[model samples]
Target: MDHSYLSSKESLDIPYITFPDLLRKWAEKNPNKTAFIFVDEEVDRYELSFGELYDKATKFAKALIGHGVRKGDVIALNGRNLPEWLIACFGIQLAGGSPLCLPYLQKKNDFVKVCSKLGRVKMLIIDPGSDGQNCQFLKEMICTDFGTNNVELPEIPDLRQVFLFNHHASLPSVNTVAELCSREWDVDLPRLDPEDLGLILLTSGTTNTPKAVPYSHHALVITAYNSIHLMKTSGKYDSLYNNRPFYWIGGFVMWEVNSGGSRVTLINAMKSSSMATAAAAVKTCEIIAREKVTVALLVPSMLDLVMKKNISLRLKTIVTGGMIVHSSLLKNIHKLCDEFICMYASTELALIACNTFTEKDITNTTKGLLSCRPLPGIEIKVTEDDGFLLPAGQRGSIQVRSTRRFNGYLNQNLPPESKETLERTGWFCPDDGGYVTEDGELVVEGRLQEIIQVFGWKKMFPFEIENVIKTKSNVSSAIVMSLKDKETGDLPPFAAIVYHPNDEESCESMQDYIRKEFNITTENRMLEYLCVPRGIVSFKQFPVLANGKPNRRAIRQIILETVDSEKYE
Candidate 1:
């Protein structure tokens, strides 16, 4: 049941081409075919034809050259899921420059400090605000619906110029997107090298600071192509619904359109104001039912909200991940959607594995991590600390190797240990602990580097123990960590939880349950020791970190000072 593949599954082969070449190919054939349908906040959907998409990108590329944007320059793009974002990105690559695709930020941080990591940014094209409550307020004050206004940038030391996308707003120094589309120029596009840097994607800093991962033109093209092939989605789907601005699947669909390979309809759920909301469950229902979206990918954070919604869905597949999904949440997703898949990936290693679930999988009693087969061209292996491969079902370090990996980090001095770790060919050890099933499926336990070495007979992973506690009554969120027992110098694990309204569960009750059911009878020595929490604490809500994961390290620091909560006895 781990890695199921029918003998009839066809061998996948993805065609690769550079951005300019792909655009030209699509524009040449079926010029009138719709390339993308962008749904705006006002519920109006605008269709951009293949010819129009290519022509606009070409004009923008020419305008970039006219404005001193040269080959090998670095330009940053900040916007929502709009045609303009794609236009600028393809234009940057067509002009032989690298486009740094930044996520839409609500609040402006220290610009000088943030921009320093980008090296020298030749120009910045940004949507002053996108579509949502946070963006609505900003858009009302700063930008037109088209996202442009003549406001001073936050003084980025390396920023040369800024461009906004509103049709009405104009500035002497700043350029409007309307001008970009029709910036009169007649110059032949520069010859692009496939190996030239095309895009820089920042890592989602779930555990640490984000790093810039550079991807070459051919690498990105092949990566996107391979992704679609792995999804096993043939022909055109009804509409590809996506919650986020940029997901790997959506990128694959875009590349499919650009490469003239497929013409599946794309539904950016975030574009329609009614679909994207500060709340999760209702928005999920609205986007799917309203758009009749056939396929989509959401994150595990949406589970709490998704469980509250009851609706009939036209969805073919619902892919979710980026955190461990509880079986309870999976039940809600399973009943609402046809197919459920868990996508396991990192910014460093894109799309490592995607495991589809079955009816039996829903009720399976195994508390271990879910299983997924590695992508066709990618290799996954389990290894011990001694640099040797481990047998199946034995937890060890996880390693992945593929040709579609990033070129390297933008800032070479990042992660300091990366040089030593990736010193070998294409193989990347993510430092996650996992075991391969006998069926060749990979199971990720958690980050081995982040595992806690509690003072005991065996060390434990906080994620494994935390997942167990989350199954408790009325628990909203749970975090497990180790605290130093000062009297005996023993480091016993502590469990902290936030409860949902109504069903009252206290620390004393949680500890008593664990001590009886876990500490007394479990024959598995490791499980018996790890599951018994030495202490339990309750918080109304967990403090969130930069990238939205619970800040366990910060919470541990606070608990160390207050109350004699570290005692195990």
Candidate 2:
């Protein structure tokens, strides 16, 4: 593969701009152009224009300023991908304030915790009754309609004002969207610089409390622009999928699509009332086929569900990550799209490496792991535990320095993940462990901190085995963890699984299948022998942590008890 094309920023046809400034430019260039196609749960569709979106955003900015919002103040947007929610986000940013988006469906305690971390951060823009019911710290509540019939203000201290959008629920001093839009509260906003904090994305926080990652106006725009070039989309009318909610890092793809000045097609799955049920995925498929969507993104798990329905997606590029993609998924998903792209990323540093897989790249050797080509302006290094750089193909902790690095973590109290992992000179080593290919592609082996420690044995990532087990049609979820060997004090990994209730693949049959798949082979003995799973255990379902990752500790305990009570072959 040629390395020359990867070094040039000149290949990026789109010009980067501050996110707020881009809105202005788009409005001027294509006033009537459809910026968003919003579909409600009821199947109603709305086509908003660049001019209309900017007008509304400007109105909201004025309203925020009128209500005493200043530059650098925090404005939290909580909702599914609604037009008004994004308008408010742009409005806050245009008002010289920063915007932080929390998933609209978050529980009360989670919302409170995020607020607490920000140290009395007060403003919250929410969907009518989403997670705003119990955020006691919000001094002002901006509520938008998201299929809710009526809005109610729950008992919350410091939550003094209620601002409504597209509704007429009147209460004492409750402001209407109409009033805000037609108001004369105008102020001159300053021009934005690259260093201005534009967006704050919350991590999954699978291990601990969710941390806030702040990206500067420059970082967000540049990263988004880079995504377009990396994906290699044609110029105009190229439509990108907008099914994922904006709260996750996956949502950054939506911003990337917009930065390219292309179309972002939103299906019904992103509505506030949507649960992304099987029906919703089907609906999304229908839209993808109907619209001839050029690009679509999905997590590896979602690919399984989508493929089960046997939907043919008219997509040119399919972007997938979030979990190790099974071979079956890789092969089958390729049948629906032209190319399969796998990206390695984190919340703080967005896109690291991108690999576009063809039929040749779908072999068994690439099943559990695919080496992704490092993107332009991104530096990746495999370093030893003591910070020494390792040679190619030698496994070590993954560290990166890239344009996508966030401005900083929000909580000044808690030391940033960058404090230890990120050096003063600007390198960030995530907990992940992986090696690089001489070709400059990175092979990600799960997180080093999350790796199941097996004493004196080859280092193995649970994702490697878990992803393999997930390839089974009957397996709904799989978790592999190291259990304490009571006799020797050494740990060996065991597989815990949740099989489909209707499917009947027994534990014995599963064990036989695993033993056969990983049995002694004729060639590459090291490769064959290293693929060992010590034991198998069954679970009804995997316990999930607060941030939606598998509760590994709980799964290990369950597996440990199974190992203790009975001896296995």
Candidate 3:
């Protein structure tokens, strides 16, 4: 078999419509049906029906138009998964503006950089800061950047309006959502085409700075429709609980407003702890149990914490992706649900492939990462760096073409590094290296840039070493990253591990075991010495992104700092 696969499955006839049109259809069909559930904690839970949601969004859109919002304008949205966030997102599209979802960045400088890069954000809608002090600080930052009339900063010249949510702060030149919603206009909402831009998403900059990726309305609708069908196969279309933030791709693409009348549950990020903490995982399980959620989409890191709780939950299906789906994670997640769906996807191409794994699938698999077949309407191929096709069982760059591919970046003049992602041909490279097995299953290795290079040309992917470390019974999670040698300028791998709580084995002993495992040399392990990590460190919790994926960049820095500090002390 060749190293390419085209989905031969027939596709459902998904509707081609704009976001506003989708909301209209669902609202008219199921007026009283609960569209979304906002779970704040154990005590507070709020639900919005289809009719109420549609009416609120329509009013918000009219208010936006009264504020001089025109078609094709770009608006920046900064908030968590609140009811206001939902209204603002859909209202912007209904008013004919694309909403650019903002990541949760604390630094003022980071926030300024994002707005400057967009070059033409017409308005900004943000949440009220933590308290009065925070609100004051944010007021100063916005006035200094956007409220100044004296200095005409070429960057963000179009940003003249600002709106704050759920606050009555008397900040200079700042508008509140209440002020906007109170105003109504007799003007009709603009009719938009299906190909109009829907929203802009920021990529996870694990290796580099995040870029702005835009998607059209039709693309988002089709993506969600196909995904609903895929999940329906396992009888999991009733209700979903997703903790991933609205800024992330998994937040919107996985579930959208449609005629299917699917219900979604969103956790209050302000009340919840970080996903790295056991508390957050406990809260996640609690919500799934209380809300009667049939399906949940989580990252592997969050699942790792839930599995450690040893508390079985009642759910129909559990979906996970956005990290290496470790075999151990797969082996244990079954206790919490009836079935497990592992997906391989990215922000560029939503939902590449997914498979429902069971106890038997995990027991029989020999690969470190399980292989999944391509989803319907997607084409996968293994190719060399120059785009030459590779044969089956040969590792190479992985490229994909799908019907739901994203529109070009907001800044089409991409940086040199990202130029190779979209080719003159239609194929887009996700910068991953993998191959097709003889059975036509796609097995993904880690990112090609993450390969560890030691003394000369001998290099290996970090997953090779990570798989070996995970074999230990006491280890909960392991991540291997390449560290550079100062004197020889060689890159050797080092491991960062999190052990099971209350385990009798000490960190020093685990380090010694890893070192001893690498030193063992046999005919099959001759190159094992070269692949060995230079050192090992223990972590209580790994730093994670807003999307719950491990923040590899931050993790690398912490590992280096911890090792260096220990060496000096």
Candidate 4:
């Protein structure tokens, strides 16, 4: 599985220096500076100096190499946000292998699926509590036992060896990755090229099969640049707290790894009460206020909860992504924080566009507008249906090409159509329909896949409908989709909204409000009658992913199933 043809120098403008190199440089530049801070076993906050982190990572790297792990092999690290997890990541990179970061809280099935997807994984590095028996790929499980006595070790049938970090056992040869870092070896460590795959992230898919996207070291470096320069991120504050899980692209690459020098605070507990939606929001707000957090990234849903709780934080910039940020939400956020930046990015591309709201830009029509341009080395083009480039102020599909783009899917087994689509150009058509304004600003309309066609007339985008509905008072979230019409034998647009749980407004009142606000009757007569949703169900809460994006697919399924069963009854 090793491909030595991919030279480390070929991967980036700066060859020989990889992500671990950056850490080493930082350590040299600021040895005593705090590299990381975490609440230790005694519930007391502990700090790791840059020099200490470098030492630990170097040893871990040597340990990995000592264990016969070679360049280009995949190493999977499964753990919550901890010092060991961070060390393992850099250590793996330093060892000349890619680190496959898995979600700490993943179920057994998902863990197995991810392991199966990563066919070339050489080893599994896990935290103390991980039940290796449930994991299918652990031929050699190395546990960095962080501080637990009652470690009910599971019998892994395929496991050939188990190495405990803090404990000594008559197991296979164990070298604390942190220990080998200082020893000098005659063998030259494999250099990191710009194009060398550095990490593998599993993206959620429509089907049960999860697709893994491998990112190069250059891709990560570009991600850091984009986060700092394009997003205008400032880490001058005391600490950085990211709520997103470490597994996802947004969490690991963009937020955690990119902000390398900052103190990354993570919430590891997962009980319903421990990580309650409201409590998470409040804790984040509190951290921002207490720690003087300069930059924070959260999903719109989490922002909504923070706003609802009236939790105030002294944040310089709060970047919200995962879903579109509503104008109303932005307006409310402005009252709490100084800047609210709306970012549009995906796992494939680090960051595409962003909109920042200063106190001045918060006024009048510029509220929910996306204000930034494409990142450096990125080219964006809007093309019409005929494959011709569209002029300014024209609506079309957004095609983007970037050096930071992912190499390809992990398996390299893209479907014929997908491969053809990608091969047409380096530009990725994420299926997002949008238009470039006269000022060259990209205005996202909606997903082409989610677009609705009713009879002969085309329907407005779901985002457009959702945006309008979201502006309504007490409406927390909304989704618009096309449902099959019994009479016309065609699909008609339908709206499903979730309002503030305690709101006492009647369905008729809400309907009237939507009808009046959207001018439902006058503009489009068909929509006024046909698009008016047949059913509007109210839930106390909205289903959301760990990263804060709405679980629309799950919600839609539940809605359909409930409605169908009701009809049958």
Candidate 5:
């Protein structure tokens, strides 16, 4: 591959530092400091120091080499957050290979799609107990706990070894692979370039097909820089705890590896309302209060639940993203936490823009509309429909250009020349309808694609309805969509609401309020007797991704599957 396209802004050329180099620097500085702390069911507490992590990673690298794992080999870590997950990631980098972090919730189709995209993965290091026995490519299985029952392993022609951390003394071992770790290796591992691929992340394809986004070592460094400088996180002052999965970019870049040498506390459990309840019940709140966790990243709904429940967690800074944060919810969050930072970002551009709330900024109705200046190494621009760059304060498609931007999607066709022109300009037309305020803040409207035409008049943005619904006391979260009307040949918008289980009356009141607020008079409306929601179906709770973002696509699918279309107007 030609490397001449890369350039450096400072002495620290991003493309020059690999993951191993970064880890080595941190280890040298904080040799005895704890790098990761995880709590497992069997092993109550698991911790690893910088020196210990480095040593283990070095041994794992040698183990891979001994098993014929060569440079550019694709390795997969397919399980929940654990010490071995980080170890496997570092080991792959040290052994000059790319590690693909797989989501624990992936089913048959998702798994098949990922495997196909990651063609011919050389090795797979999975948690045998957590991952179950359905993996298609199980070259090596490692159980972090010793007492886990040894189930029948999957049939893989390339499988070579199984290393159990706690049960290595009694498990049925095999040849061609060693149960030994870094404690047994005295040899040094190979190095990597900054441009070398570090991890392969699959983009969240809510509106379209999923694409594999490959991040280089330089890109990872840029993520760390953004976290430290742009987000203003300090190791000396800030303690971080992240429950997000290690697979997604938001989790991996923002939570797991962003702080460099700072300690990261991981919650190794499936994410759900029950899990949240269990965590709160276990006095995790007390632990957080004791540790004085200054910075945190939580999903909006989860934050709402935590705040509503009055969990006494002392947090100085709380940043919410990965989904839209309602104005009402934003204000409530501000009252709960010392400092609240609301951000809008995607995998393509790690942390595009964030709103750091001042006391005055918090009370503004435009609180959710504040525009953020591009980070040090990034550039942003807005453009019109004709592809002309728009000046400040003008509403147009927003585009971004950053040194941290991903190279391209794997196994996916590149956008056309016309589309490429839009992308190269760094003016991402997020297709979100919103204008930059006079104060240079970006106000995100609803998605341009989601706008509906009702009776030839453009109806309100879905976000508008969602925001309004969220203001209703009992409504937890809401999604509004335009449903087609068969009789009138018009698209009328309807809302699917998720309310507190006991708030049936509140839901009915909201329906009445919306009908009057939107002025949906029975005489003028196409469906005279039927208000908007031809059918109202309630869900126990909305599906949420590991990163705390609502699984809108999944929820939409569930709604479509459960409700009868013919019943509605």
Candidate 6:
């Protein structure tokens, strides 16, 4: 936790460069070096070397320019993690156009609504259907309604064309990316500026409408350098295994590719499915050991699965974040690697803070409040509702200021809450509440807006009850959130718990224990009576987002339905 050993650089010290230029630098320096490793189930995989990736991306860039992709055009790239996805993404940047990364959704209305929200998408390049024939939904939409001018579909007004991967069936009015990439076009690609819009990343649409977050080439490079700096590795041979989707900031190639280090990603056989399956996790662990991956970025869920395999994994470091690092998981870190790192980051603000825990450090630290040291170039503080800066150890709203903050959202009306959060003077509120310890470690409690109002004016953070629930011997992990009472319109807390595998308790018994614990805590005045959860739901494991954070939105819906069913019974 020493700032003296951390990576630090003034804003001017970091190099600002374009993505295409960065790719070219790597290709020239390490031409034959493996840049990307794409793995499938059963250890089947392929490698994309830097030279080959650059050559393909350049050709694809020319193809894009030939297809009328001008600078600043927002082209939608929707698909699973594949070699083609990375190539097409870099090609878009090479052509001076911004690639709008979209998840591979199957429903027609869902796809159209997401595309329409961005306003006038220039083109869409998506993968084939699960059957590998074609995107049936899109084929139906374009052929039936989008004849020639696409005048019939007002939703996607500016959509000029749709292109599927070559494996799909040939259909009328649809083009194939293979044909485009194979086209020998001599069109001049536009010159790209370092500050040009590089790519567009959508906010994880778990809670609200997915907002478009645009990052410039400069921002990408700066963050990429910071990421590489964090690995604290000098050799280019150190490999990373990351299963996060390419659309996510965590899985972004900019982070690892800049280091000239190789990265391995899990490629789901079914294109539509994005979740990392248990089979995939086992395969990932096999790849990690076989390939001798030094630093791996496995989300807590994936880590738990990998660890359950009881494989001996000794690596340089294992990086995790975007979820609460449970005590059980933290305790098992020594079995995985020499150093464990948990980060605090968001789409809006890049890498905010991280804690590097050695085995000894983990043993010495308190298990309750997880703390992180702020990264270089990031200024974070906890402030009261009135904008008063709270002293160390006093919990309040967390705000951050950084030069590398994302460019504003694109083509969407800002929600009032989002508007207020960003409109603050020189600070961006990440909607998280936490405190800073006297040692300067930042402790993130939970979401600020997720505070549950139980009685007329009594409110409590979800973590307050969650922390208490996790203290039970049988509980492995617990998530507490508020649900609106249909009858009374009050927000009361509910608990979703994952019990220890060996110490599993029956639901009836666990409920009784939870109530007893709550009663004891209330009697001792450690917690208020109103803070007790109204209902308890047990889970083998909690559902998580693609980025590996607990999926509270889905959890809330599940809890609501469970409560309703119980009442009916």
- Please, what are the lDDT tens digits per residue for candidate 6 over residues 1-569? 32211123433367767877777888999889988888875568799999888888888889888777788888888777788888889888888888888765535665577778777578777777546533665657764333342323567877776666555554445555666676677887788888898888877766655677888898888778778666666436688877777887777786557778888887752321233456656666778888889998876756766676665567889998875555466777788899888888888777777878888876767465567876778788788887678888776888787778643578575557556756665477777888787777787877876777644665567866776676676676788877776666666777888877778766566556656766755345434435667678887776755434457778777887777853321
Q: lDDT (0-100) at residue 1 of candidate 6?
A: 31
| Candidate 3 accuracy as TM-score | 0.87
Global Cα lDDT for candidate 5? 0.59
- Tens-place lDDT per residue, model 3, 392-416, is 9887888888877653576546545
TM-score to true structure, per model: 0.79, 0.82, 0.87, 0.79, 0.80, 0.86
User: Where is model 2 more than 4 Å wrong at Cα?
Assistant: 1-17, 129-173, 176-179, 253-280, 305-309, 326-334, 359-368, 412-421, 483-491, 494-496, 504-509, 520-569
Q: Give residue 67's error in model 2 in angstroms.
A: 0.2
**Which number leads on TM-score?**
3
lDDT of each: 0.62, 0.64, 0.71, 0.60, 0.59, 0.72
Q: Which residue pairs collide in model 4, if any?
A: 8-193, 11-193, 11-194, 11-195, 12-194, 58-181, 59-177, 59-181, 60-177
Error of 5 at 116 (Å): 1.3
Compose the digit string of candidate 5's lDDT tens values, residues 1-569: 11101112332234357767767776777777766666554435567777777777778888878667777877766666766767777888888888877666455455556656557565656654443332323322323222332223233333333343222223334321224463465455666778888788776665555667788887787776666654567664566655567777666734324354344455454543224443553455554554456676766666766777766555677777766566556556655567777777776667666667645655575444444555556555566666666665555565566756544567575667535764565434445655555555566666655555556654445776666566677776677765555666565556677776687554456677767755777566653223345445566776665334457677666666655566433
Residue pairs with backbone atoms closer than 3 Å in model 6 (clashes): none
Candidate 6: stretches off by over 4 Å: 1-12, 144-152, 170-174, 269-281, 305-309, 415-424, 453-460, 463-478, 484-490, 497-508, 516-522, 525-531, 537-551, 561-569
How far residue 557's Cα lies from its native spot in candidate 4, in Å, is 2.7
Candidate 1's displacement at residue 96, Å, is 1.2
Report model 2's TM-score to 2 decimal places.
0.82
The full ranking of all candidates by TM-score, starting with the best, is 3, 6, 2, 5, 1, 4
